[model samples]
Target: MTITYEETRELAQRTVVDARYPNINIYTLDAIWVLYDRVLRVDPQRIDDPARDRFLLSKGHGPSAFYAVLAAKGFFPAEWLDTVADLESPLGSHPDATLVPGAEISSGSLGHGLPLGVGVALGQRATGHRDAQVYVLVGDAELDEGSNHEAIAYAGAVGLANLNVIVADNDSASHGWAGGIASRFAVNGWSTATEDMHDHDALYRAFTAPHPDRPHVTVATVRT
Candidate 1:
């Protein structure tokens, strides 16, 4: 069945609202759209096109929005989204790059995406694809891992101007409100921004602008 972007977006919102139990650490559907619609860029059929920007859903559980976006973009039949995470499904709860056309990395583990994104940016530079930007959408709670810091520091030191680290802060991470995450990124030389993650226009601007000589990081402080 064909699904419009609106339907895809709505289902994604409903899935997160209904799928998880009342008490769980998983991200909400609202948060999914907040980041996915705002930060990532893609063209499903031509995902591998050299001009297409790379998007890594580091907050892997937010597959609702990711799948919805891909479906709407015609990466696959829209009906396939209904089977996401099913035993027979190719669309897992977290994306599998080898399986998903638009995904840059396979991730369920936190703290892995940013480093991978950094690597992608480095690869882009080395390959003379300097215009391609790698964007990683990480969960604020995932920062519990020391590796997130390592990735941020390395991005700063390496000066990956074409890479973007987007932290989806949905006011639910770490006992409500992930603390000092923006400051952490700032200290590491990443230009940071905090705003309602659902604000699409603001996030679009943030995601598109390249840092002059350093990695660009935007921590979207969402209140979903």
Candidate 2:
């Protein structure tokens, strides 16, 4: 059951108790839903499979969207959406891997996702996992973190073919990149691309593009 943007948004809205922030990054959520629906590999019955695709939400501050998608995908109960951030709820502002059924990592402290994704991608290759793909979603502002640059350089150098990064570019970076985010990755040997965040078809194509012997990055631009 592929969830549409409208459906995902409605599901997410159910979890929003305060309208002030909505506790979700709507642009990133809408963009990423396409990747999960059209590109990511998964087997609810075989999550432990080494070849099963992994998705790490590096932009974790606004997790209502993540929880909504997970619930829609049957990662957990749909009812859990209403309980998010409540006292008994396992779902918090930032996803906790041990608590969230489908989350690969617990991330909120910026600049950690890409590095962790690089590690996952490298490990999968070393273990001879033929088809696993490791994906990380990051905010444009998070790129300011030096740790991400180190990971980007290392992943590109090692030719992490199984790694993919989707940077939600909302122009929130205090010190923005000169030639845009794609250029940074390109210089480091990554196969890079950019597309409007609202264009699901374009995003799908970019996200699925082949980058043999190199890591891939797709920057989805969102209006701030």
Best by TM-score: 2
**What residue runs in model 1 are displaced by over 4 Å at the alpha carbon?**
1-5, 14-41, 175-179
Which residue pairs overlap in candidate 2's backbone? none
> Across residues 195-216, which tens digit of lDDT does each residue of candidate 2 receive?
9998989999998898888999
**For every model shown, what is its TM-score relative to the native structure?**
0.83, 0.94
The root-mean-square deviation over C-alpha atoms between each candidate and the true structure, in angstroms, is 3.4, 1.8
| TM-score result, candidate 1 | 0.83
Model 1 per-residue lDDT tens digits across residues 1-224: 65554686675654432245423333333334444555445666667776667877777765777776666656777667666666777787678889876677898887888878878888888888887778787887887677888888888887778888778776546654335678887877888776566566676677667587888777776553
Q: How accurate is candidate 2 locally (lDDT)?
A: 0.85
lDDT of each: 0.70, 0.85
**Backbone collision count in every prediction?**
0, 0
Best candidate, lDDT: 2
lDDT score of residue 76 within candidate 2:
82
